[model samples]
Target chain A: MGPPWWQAKFRGCGYRITIAREVILNTLAKTEDHLSAEDIYNHIHTKHPNIGLTTIYRTLDVLTNLGLVYRFDFGDKRARYELAEGPKGAHHHHHLVCTGCNRVVDYTDFIDAEVRLLQEIEQVLSKKYGFKITNHLIQFYGLCSRCQADG
Target chain B: MGPPWWQAKFRGCGYRITIAREVILNTLAKTEDHLSAEDIYNHIHTKHPNIGLTTIYRTLDVLTNLGLVYRFDFGDKRARYELAEGPKGAHHHHHLVCTGCNRVVDYTDFIDAEVRLLQEIEQVLSKKYGFKITNHLIQFYGLCSRCQADG
Candidate 1:
């Protein structure tokens, strides 16, 4: 209840917890869908018409750089974002993007086999390339059920 | 060798095999590095000064749409491209990107364990979301050894 964890992070990074940033973060935090800047603007425009699209874009950049948000490009030319740490805690997952309909599914079921594979891959890559591996992104592209049915 | 396989694909898609396209494809095909449109233009500019950057950009869009190239976003804002099919055949691989230097290494050692894990994940995701999975992309981000040493 005390200002939330991310506000402290914002202060720690020399960034003031501005209202625009707060609203943008809250908008992303509420949605399971990966939303474009325009989408975020649309979500809050009615209630907070003072917030401009440019401000949302700039704030999203700040949040992403602060590791408070994750940005993604699903081959759509535009970037989409979601809260990096969701209400479910550190909701780490990858994406399943529908090429047909641009629907995105967050695949959160990181099973044991996945853990082992990533461990092995990181080990091999670190040894081979001398990389200090930190993070990874995986996205699968195909048709969602509704799109397939339409086709 | 006879006009290469991709030319036929272009023709099959009703796209003419233009020289600018050929040069762009050749430039990407020859390199292991993911080249931005500017990088491709830079590589071919001295020899083919007439082929402007606009042509390069336009051709890249066509090639990307035709599925003759794969486009990637390494969080660098610029899109990088590589040939879909290489001289060594379909060179399917993931990337390990150095956040410090923007270095990209193709991780091609797809072991049996990795393959099995992907199959399992695809199957599980397909059942859960009813998605007909097609292709995937994986990218790991971190500091390369040089960057770590420099730090």
Candidate 2:
């Protein structure tokens, strides 16, 4: 309906949409799964072998700074990213990361009770600690089904 | 109470208790705040100048493996550690990290609703994804009072 997200996000900014950056953004947009820089690089490399890994990493940082992407650590050593311009509710979903097999499941099924609980928690934290809450991250660590079966 | 946590943690295991390991554990036990590897090294370096940074790193790996310590990343690009032997509820508490000044508030005022939410999420995830749930981490990122004031 309106302007596409990438344009809207950087219209005011001087960030020129390079081919590499465009490929990275498009790759993330199409994926429903969280991906590390290496993962993105590998995917982009298949289509655009000329795109360097460093370019992907740099573009990812720019996207994260521009708020077009979300970067998080799932207790995994590497940082993972997802497109923040996706569907509204999709951006706030939490993660279920399997510690054994390193499987990540994006869980967005926030019940009414959970929403109320988060609101209460944010209220309490903001009042008690004088923090102006902006964002939150939650991840559950465990074993995936295949790993559980193996274990 | 029962042979001390460090001793019990390595009781049956072939891990011998070294002076360096004890210092590492004792240092973690003393601090309620998360300490990075460099932070821990600095604290112990003053008292035990002989203890090398490599020793601290190795000891941290051992402690983390034994579940005697907790390791997490606060999007700060450094791994942070905290003692796992804190109060029952203390271990399960979440973190409120200030993006402005990087202050971390360890919030433990969890009610039954939060626990229930987690259980529900875990059950649903485990059922749908065949995950064997074990643990979880939650953190809220925002501006602290000082940062809010500065802004």
The DockQ leader among the candidates is: 2
lDDT of 1 by residue, B1-151 (tens): 4877687778888888888888898888788788999999899999999999999889998988887788888878898998887556545678899999898988787655666778778888988999999877778889999999999
Candidate 1, residues A1-151, lDDT tens digits: the string is 6767787788888898888888888888788788999999999999999999999999998988888788888878899988886456545778899999788888887555576688789988999999999887778888999999999
- RMSD per model, one decimal: 2.7, 2.6
What DockQ do the predictions score, one after another?
0.72, 0.77
> Clashing pairs in model 1?
none
For model 2, residues B5-113, the per-residue Cα lDDT tens digits are 5586586788998889989888888778799999999999988999998988898998888887888777677889988754442456678999877889988776456
lDDT scores of the candidates, listed in order:
0.85, 0.81
Instruction: Write candidate 2's Cα lDDT for A1-151 as tens digits.
Output: 7755567667678878678888898898888878999999888887899999889889988998887888988766788998885555255667888887687887777655566788889999999988999877778888887887786
Q: Residue A104 CA error for candidate 1 (Å)?
A: 0.9
Instruction: Please identify model 1 stretches exceeding 4 Å from their true place.
Output: A110-112, A149-151, B110-112, B149-151
Each model's chain A TM-score: 0.88, 0.85
Rate residue A16 of model 2 by lDDT: 83
lDDT of 2: 0.81
